[model samples]
Target: MSLETIIYIIFAGIIALLLALFQYFKKGKNRSKLDLFFSFLRFVTLFSVLLLIINPSFDQIELSIEKPSLVIAVDNSSSIKHLKQDDKTLGFVKSLKNNTELQEKFNVNIFTFGNQLREGDSIDFTDKQTNVHDAFKALSQIYKNTNAPTVLLTDGNQTFGNDYQFVTNSYKQPVYPIILGDTVSYTDLKIQQLNVNRYAYLKNEFPIETILVYNGSERVASTFVVYQGNQKVYSKPLNFSKQDNSKIIHFTLPANKVGVSAYRAEIKPIENEKNTINNIQNFAVEVINEKTNVAIVSDFPHPDLGALKKSIENNEQRSVSIVGVKEFVSKVNDFQLIILYQPNSKFKPVLENLKTLKKNYFTVIGTKTDLHFINNSNLGYRVDITNQKEDYQGVLNTNYSPFYIDDMGFESFPPLLSNYGGVQISQPIDVVLNKSVQNVTTNDPLLFTFEAEGRRQGVLLGENIWQWRAHSYLENQSFHEFDNFIGKFVQYLASNKKRSRLNIDFQSFYNGNSHVIIKAEVFDKNYVFDTREVLHITVKNKGSKTEKTFPLILKNNHYEVDLSGLEPAEYEFSLSTKNDKITKTGSFKILEYHVEQQFLNANAEKLQQLARNSSGTSYFINNANGIIKELLEDKRYVSVQKSSKNTIPLIDWKYLLGIIALSLSMEWFLRKYNGLI
Candidate 1:
């Protein structure tokens, strides 16, 4: 309390005392014991009222001891069970959590991770995949600003995601890894990796690549063979020792039949090999009979032409031919899709031929493009151009449903150059990317698609798209994402199929470890997407002669069904609507592969490196007592004394008001009873 508050309290007491004296010792008042009691009551009531009127506040201090957090992240993937360490892992975690010293010194938090991170001690060890990198990332975010040391318990075998060893650099807390599984090296022969294209042309030879590895000191000889169903198609003798332990085998197989074909590659394991499961691998490819031929017709050469050709031809089933407008006019009927690059008066003949034949074409407009010719071309759109050029960036439309396309971080791509203009479309169109200028998004289409008279047409309002491809590679170190985006657009244009009420999208082959999802879209009579329709799919296993039916759940703007429970075999499926008679049929194959069962031993070196990088120690599960001792001895993770101060009212208003009301009521009753009122 301040001096001003103290002075106010003194003055309030003096006034209360004076009022009590005046009430009892007035000029004609009698001096009696009852009068004294009444005076006392008046003094108490008056003093409380004055104190309440002042309402002074005082500072309150509180102290607490904050203990450092200790996070325990356990691996709950299937690989743990494959290595026969699930029970041992569970026992270790239970014993650690029950330790009295740990409970008293730190706040213990338990987590489990497989495909994702979850909080609990429920360790079923049934997860299909292991992602140690994601586990570390999630833990770093959860305890970013706190002193939380993590205890990672895993085999250090990640089936998917980025390398886990390098992820330790971003983590601020120390990570003590308790390695699981046997670290002993055995005489193991394994197929490290296999590479094959998804699609192959019928009657053509498709390339297959395999990498074989051996992990024994003694020299061994084996036979590497590939089988198509029950018949052996290829074989080679392989020799390996400690020095020469790896070999790359490349060969080609003929795709004589047009369907999904499954193949298995095996490296015969040497005698006394303990883990033979890693010796065989399965793969599949679809033999497609039809191929798409796309032509790029331009008046002059540009880098965009070469970029388009390379991106489109990344898939083995599609080919791109770059030709001038004069050469392309005569060969218009040879290609299914035509790409017109920066069309001007020279493209008049090409555009006329496309219009006459009702062929699909994609138009790309740039600064060099003649706006007057484009405006008079009657291509369902007109641009009122200006003499100025503008660099505009692209913003993706999340609602685009013509085909599934990811965002791919389009906002960071380099801007494209185009003439400043007001674009107007005369027909209904789907805008995939909108125009953005100077960080402000505009209601203009940068890339759009429309259909007219049974033909599809795509229009891009800018150029310099080659830079977009290069930027994508710089970001991801691969052109797969950008090329896939272009492939979807080209696939939509190359197909001459008429618009239908139902469209289905799926793959012809899937690995057993991957999810088999089929997506579908339904349209009403007027060609508008309908969300009220119900869909279902019936699948028939060709090998087992078994049938099953599943309902398709409605997702965002589409319906989908997951067939991940199906066994590895050839299967045919039919999709049908509930209210209408619309149906579509397709077939797919799932290859036999188990990624978790391929490991022979634990990855101890990477885990040790991870511990070293994070300033922690690595230990085996059987000898992990040193970790607890070290954690207890570490001085950096000690408890911190935290204090906080707050200003609070000295008197509670409720109790003060009660005291004042009780005194006033008692004094009034006493005066009335004595007939002194």
Candidate 2:
């Protein structure tokens, strides 16, 4: 087939030719007529032996017709164990065992699937989760053999990934699906949505919103209670409007302490049902009291100052301070945000340091600033008052507003800015206004906002925001709206103006190793943890998978991890824990040298799918007595057929042995005849 092999054959033929010629000449000289004939025969035999030495072989293989494999997929989910469904699956298993005709024709393998695949024996359907993807995966592995057809028996309830059809289609085997059990109408109630603030003040009320849904059921009045441990902090009556609808229940519960708080809302069933866990879902929200201290710096204390302070006081969590600009600049970084009230004309000297607290500063410009200071503030944008009315009534103008002390804190709201021609107005189109402000038109930049360095900055060009409180108090409205606005503005300006990032201290996994690796990510408030890295890790505990310490790794805006060799078990890992202070904690499962075999094969459903895909049958031991029968009854399982001639090459013993015997005998006879023994 190759040039080198051809050349080697030709060279061997040349050598044989030379040897034959020499033998012919030498034998001719010494032989008589009768001996010449025998010698010629011997020469022919030698030529034949030389040709056979090359060693060529040809084989004929006989094959039987391939039949579709019977894939016996069994559902091992808890639902399969339902009184009626369990009996059905059991009966089917028995039927398969008795059906000898079907057994003899198809190759059968048993498999069971639920959350994962269980080979050999079917998993008991005591587990509560149904996973159909596992069955498909199990059958796919068997279908790779390219000889067995797959048959599946399932109710077809999927509870896992979405690639079932894609994986099954890989093998061109026909899937014989056996529908099991009758489909029952399922009506359920569940906690559809929940909202909680992670950081709530200690001993203060925290607002929570919970949405409850009732599917396939009519409207019903229900009671929902919030429980903190054994204490029932709050409860309320909830009434659903109709079937396929939901009700939103709002609660304001007091936090007694500053730490992690576990809360659960229990919904009493209006209609008794088989399943109740779905009716009551438990959710945990951490109640943190890590509030930032804020200091407000204004040129002079005004009438609205008391109203602004009163709102934050009601919160009982935040501390607010009012000070002059001179004192604030001396100790600026001590507080979160600094509110400037008509700051001194020469505030430019501290602009660089002011930028350091970009999200931390809120400037409220008054009518006192001269034209020189207003035009040359060096604050990125200019703030100028084009109109100033002596007297004004604070009438409601815009219902929507997007302007806030901290732009990064909350989502944008509807336009709330309006023109108050009576107030000192900065005529421009890039501003937001509250509804209480005077009405005007166009995209006016009455306020310019930005966050530079670490502070949230805003410039309110209007002088008379305090008029809102004065006007509201005159109307006997209790100044609630004014207080709300000021409190929210202060909170936004003072709050942290950065994204959440994971800062891992160090991590470790133990496998008889005394020392552990410590790794961490270097980040600022603006950076996130997401990447892979190798660093020093620390170890804790006696080295068990159940309680191991692997500090979180930070790379590319995510926490990184590599638990390849961890033992098989659930591990509770944390990052940056000192004196029981855990920065973060998550659960991870490591099985079988971290190869994921335990997880990959944990669901019986996947195993059944793999078998079905390979044109083979999956089975379960609980009803596998018919496996032998199925194999025997398969049409392809007939007696082995043989060919007339050898299907495979065999040794040419007659020719080989004869050559050896004759060569040795001739040598002996020649020696005897020549008397040279």
lDDT against the true structure, per candidate, is 0.90, 0.52
Query: How do the predictions measure up, each by TM-score?
Result: 0.83, 0.43
Residues 1-677 of candidate 1 have per-residue lDDT tens digits of 89999999999999998999897878464577787788889999999989988988878899999999999999998888999988889989998899999999999999999889999889999777889998888888999889998999999999988898978678889999999987898889999999999899999999999999999899999999999989999999999999999999999999999988889999998999988888989998889999989999888889999999999999878999999988898888889999999999999999889989999999999988999999998888998777999999999986665666667889999999988866999999989999999978899999999889889999999999999999999988799999999998899888877767888988998897788999898878876677899999999999988999999998867788999878889899989998887999999988888888888778999999999999888999989878888999999899999999988775764788888999999999988988878
In model 1, which runs have C-alpha deviations exceeding 4 angstroms?
Answer: 1-65, 299-307, 390-401, 407-417, 436-442, 466-479, 579-581, 642-677
Per-residue lDDT value at 434 in model 1 = 94
RMSD of each: 5.1, 20.7
Worst 10 residues of 2 by lDDT: 592-601
